[model samples]
Structures are given as structure tokens and as C-alpha cells.
Target chain A: MTIRKTASDYSRSHEPIVWGLFSAGGVIVAFFIPALILLTSLLVQVGIADEAVLSFDRVQSFAQAWWGKLFILAVIALSLYHTVHRIHHGLHDVHIHIPDSLAIIIFYGGATVLSCLVFVWLLAIGW
Target chain B: MSTSEKTIYRKPYVQNQSASWWLKNKFYIWYMVREGTAIFVFLYALILMLGLLRLAQGEAAWNAWVASLSNPAYIVFHGIALIAAMYHVHTFFKMFPKVIVIRFGNWKMPESYLIAGQWVGFVVCTAVILGIGLFVGV
Candidate 1:
């Protein structure tokens, strides 16, 4: 849509790194988020998991398991990355332009910090 | 004849743009809702992360966390978040095919195949997780 294409006018963006994370996170959420909300909320609210499932003892042991830790890490980190990326671009599409440096530091930077915290918390309780 | 020349420019009309510009169009509104789903999804994730953190801290912490979730307000919030997450998943599946086009030697693989395959994979994975927990006594 420009009068002429110029070499200096176009450049590849480094978006794919975050886009990949966003896409993976979306896939993960698509696969599980609704079910997660359902199982954790509705089922627990009902008779299911009242005494046994998700009980303190059960949940603690589940978290202590390696597979449980991996699942938690993947879900939390990816979902945060996905959500922040969406919010960042969502602002742009709405014509709310924040400075790029600040947006990056806040959104992606926050994700990095939280993801690290998840890893640490997972480790703190020991195997 | 030497004359003073005046430059005259016509002012162009500009469309009204506002922070709520998306409200002007149905499609834009829908798109905004899709993007906004992430907020609810993030809220759900944050609560879950807190639950995980408390679970890691030990039985006392996990019990307190579970007790907190029983609040009426938390239940209401989770209800809204659940609905939003469902919409997010629906939009995610629809848009996923555009992200990666599957191609065969000459003809392209149909988008339907990819979408269906994703659902199948989702089912299999979910089954594996649940089955192990049940069978292994975890």
C-alpha cells in the first residue's frame, strides 16, 4: 500500500518467540482450561472430592510428585505468557500505544518473574 | 504579470477514533471479546498458581487455600472465568488452523483434519492423565 517498497522500510520482527509461546499456551488452555475450571469448582462444590480428592493430604502428595510439578509449571508459565502477549497486542489494536520498551518490561518481564517463582515454589517443598 | 501566489489546501475529513472505537463495529467487538478472554484465563491461572503454592507449603497451607476457595465471591468469579475460558478455547481452535497450514506433496491438507487431530490429541492426553491417577492410585 505504499508508493514504493524500500529495504529500510521492512524488517522481520522478533514476535515469533512470544507468538510461539502464546500459541502453545492457547493449545494448552484449549485442551484443559475449561475442564480444569469444571473439575476444580463444580465437582468440588458437589459431592465429588468432598473428603478424599483434593483433600490436603491428596493435593500435597500430588504436588510432591514429579509429574504434578511438571504439569503445574507448564500450565502456569505458558498461560501467563499467553495472556500477557494477548493483552500487549490487544492494547495496540485498540490504539492505546504504550512505549514498546515499557510494555515489554511490564508484560513479558512480569511473566518471567512469575514463571521463576513457580519453579522455585515447586522445588521448595522437596521431592 | 507578477502576482503573489497563495497556497490553499483542503482539510480532509477524519473518522472519529476513540478508546472505545471497537464498539463501533460488531466484528471488532467480537474480536475484542476474544482477546479479553485472556484476562479471565489469567485470573483462573493466578488462583490456580496460588493453590499450587499453598499445596507446596504443606497441609496447613493447602487447607487454608482450599477454605479460601469456598468463598461465595470466589465461586462467582470462577463461574465467570469458566465461561470465558470455554469461549477462549472455542476461538483458539478456530484460529489455530490459520497459524499453521498443513500441506501434502501437491495438495494442501484440509483444515478440518488439523482441527480434528487436535481434539483427538486433547482427549488422549486428558485420558492419560486421569487414567494414571486412577489406576496408579495417585
Candidate 2:
């Protein structure tokens, strides 16, 4: 007897999982990043924001807290996933051809590794 | 290998596109610009990661990291990043209404309201972050 394979035999795509993270990251970026950029960079340059606002003692204490660690991890990890997903697909827009599998491994894998590093670093900071 | 076990392959022709294809039209250019914002976002995240690493190193290292931001080049980069992030916000908010569908039973929420609500959320988030940084001491 001969067997036939239909579309259902194929495994599902992982696009949805990454796309969901990308959307969440987009919302985070839209709502939080401008103000963060202002606080970290432009305000400091123009002397409107005191450099001490980000002093080691204050920032360290904040980051050492459970909430602060969660907040930082969420922002960095989500943003990494969002941006790397964009950059991965953007390669095609510019006509830079690479195996899609390789691109996925490189971009998504890198984001995962970096996020893990951030989590580890946050723990090292301690409460 | 047996000849009957060999697989035959077919090659299909794909249209060749230039690397600068996006530069051909204004709309495409803007789309590319929107996508390009990812680079800035990625870099800023790296800066934060470096800051985190420095923070773990100790107060002196953290101070040095903060002081490094005072560089003229760093300021310029941040300025560009700020603009890019805002543009991202604009584009993202505009796209949100289409991406998410909301309705009240039979009554669907208008796109305008959805977009406006996002702006409200944005304002609230910005306020909270800035308020903490300014009044709460980081």
C-alpha cells in the first residue's frame, strides 16, 4: 500500500511565538524607550537631568530590588527579541540572501544568549 | 546507489533585486527607515547591558560608564537614537489598531479610539518612568 503526506504532516511554524514577543516589545518601546533615552542621554547632555540621578548607589539599590530586576529583565529581553526579529527579516528587504534557518539561529539565538547574560548579571548585582 | 533511488530536482527562476531596491520609492524608503530603527534599539539595549555589567563590577566602574556618556559622540548617537525611538513609537502606534481587534459585543471600537488609547498609555508610561527618575532618585 502507498501512503500520502498532506500539509497536516508538517510541523507548525514558530513565527507566532516570536511575533507575539515582537509585538509586546513594540508596545514597550513605544511607551517606555523615548523617556528612557531622554533620561539616559539627552537630558544628561543638556544638563537638565542631574548626573546623580543615575548614580551608582541609587541605581544599584534600585536594581537590587526584586521589582527592579524584573523590570530591567523584561525591557532588555523583550526589546532584544523585537529588534533581532526585525533585523532578521530586514536582511531580505535589502536583498541580502542567507539561509532562513541560519538567520533564525543567529538572530534569535543571540537574543536568547544576551538575555540570559542580563539575567545572570542582574542576579550578580544582588539584593 | 541504485538509479531508481536517486531524486530529481527542479530549479525555479527568481527575479533578481538590487540591494538598493528600497531607495527607489519614498514609501519604500520610509519603510526601510522604520525597519532600520531596530539597529538603534539594539545598540541602546547593548549600552544598558554594558551599564548592568559595570554596575555589577562596582561603583567606580558604574561611574566610569555613566561618565562615558558625556562624550560628544555618545551624545550625538543618543540624540539619533531618541529620534529613532520616537519614530518607532509613531509607526508602532499607527500599526497597532490594525494588529489588534477590539470590540464590545456587537460594537467594534473605532481605530481612532484605539490609536488614541495607545497614546494615553504611552504618556502614562513616560510619566511614570520620568517621575521615578526625577523625584524618586532613579
Candidate 3:
């Protein structure tokens, strides 16, 4: 079933909030992801970083730090929502149209669920 | 024939783009790649989230998780993810200028300038983050 939209309702769509999250997530991906890749993957393999860099002691310390927790929270939650928003539009652009309500619920719901989990886990880290 | 007397009936070519249009050309393929990178990025975020969860569980679990990172398969996965992330960064910067409008005195900022500004901001932000992390003993 289609809910009719007046001009104002159409104009005041909640999409911008998703778009804002998407854009913020894009910034996190751009600025931080390479460093993450280096730290977690390439550096240790290539021997530029010590194996201890990712050792539980150091990483846990980092995660327990206030800034680390905040940063990780932002990166995880924002990227999830960003990717979901992209997936939502990309699916539409590629002509995989389900009902709008269903599409929104699935895409946004998945992000929201995982984001809440991320927050809970971040806090559970005992900072 | 006077111009007003001519009645031309032209057939309208009503062609809707196919869903697989991105597969047809390099341009579309690249656009798809740019869009597709988001999933890999989301995966990376999930990986980090898992790491956080493991950290919360205590050293044994966290260390085991860390140890798994050295696996050849995990390494290769991360490498692909790294490429996807770089593509995301490049494309995100390219899109920045389109969304942002800036003026310098009477002149509008060029797209190149806008792109460069994003890079500069990223660099500065990274430095600040690293500096804080180090100084704060993290």
C-alpha cells in the first residue's frame, strides 16, 4: 500500500538525516581506514610494525581510552549507517524496487540494530 | 513548405536503462565499484567492532583474535578491503566539491581546491588524532 505524500511531507523527507550520516561515514572511511589497514594488516606482515602493536595489551588499552572508545563508536556506527544508506539507494538505482516502507525498514533497520550493538559492545569494553 | 505547415511525427524512443547498465562500460563499472566499496567499508567497521567485543572479553580472547589476523586468508581479505577503502576515500573527496560551495573573496573556489582542502583536512585530523592518542598514553 502506498501512503500519499503532500508536497511538504515529500519535501521534509528523513532522507537528509541518512545522507548526513552517509557523508560523515565517508569522512571516517577516507581519513581512517587506510591507517587501520596498515596497522592491522600490512605493517605487521611487512615487518615495519612489531607483532606487539596489535597485542591484546596495547589494543585493549587503546580501546579502553576515552578517545579511542569515542572514535571507534563513531567509525562503526557511522560507517554502518552510511553503507546502509548507500545500499538502499544503490538497490533502487539498480531497479530492485521493493515497497518503500519495506526497503527503509530492512536497510535502516539493519544499520540501527548493528549500531546499537556496537554501542553496547563499546561500552562493555569497560573504559 | 512553409515552416508552420510542416507536421513532423517523430517516434519517441522510450528506452529505460537496464539494471545491469553498470556492467556495460568502464565508466559505469567504476561508478559501481565506488558504490560497492561501501560494503567492504562496512565489513571493516564490523571487524573493528568484533575486536572491541573481544577486548571487552579480556586478554585471552583479544589476543586470540589478534593472532587470527596473521592468517594468509585474513591478510588477503584485509588487502582487498584496503583497496576498497582507498577507492572510497578518493571518490568521497571527488564528490566533496559538488556538495560544498565556497567562495574566496569575489572568486569561487575551484573543484581542485575543494578536493585538496579535503585532503588537507584529513591530514590535519589524522595528526591531531594520533597526537592525542600518543599524549593521552593510549
lDDT of every predicted structure (CA atoms): 0.81, 0.90, 0.80
Instruction: Report the TM-score of candidate 2, chain A only.
Output: 0.89
Candidate 2, residue B55: lDDT: 98
Which candidate's DockQ is highest? 2
Model 3, global lDDT: 0.80
Angstrom error at residue A123, model 3: 1.9
DockQ of each: 0.57, 0.71, 0.51
Model number with the top TM-score: 2
Comparison by lDDT, 1 against 3, better one = 1
Tens digits of per-residue lDDT for model 1, A60-108:
6667789888988898899999999998999888898899999989999
Using DockQ as the measure, what is the rank order of every candidate, best first? Answer: 2, 1, 3
**lDDT by residue for model 1 over B18-136, one digit each (tens)?**
88888989999999999999999888888888887887778888887777777888888888988888788777777888878987689887888887887787777667654544334
Q: Give the TM-score of each candidate.
A: 0.87, 0.89, 0.85
Off by over 4 Å in 3: A1-11, B1-13, B124-138
Question: Model 2: DockQ against the native?
Answer: 0.71
lDDT of 3 by residue, B1-138 (tens): 556866679889999898888889999899988888877877787788787788888989988888887789888888999899888888889988988888878999899988998888877866765454333433
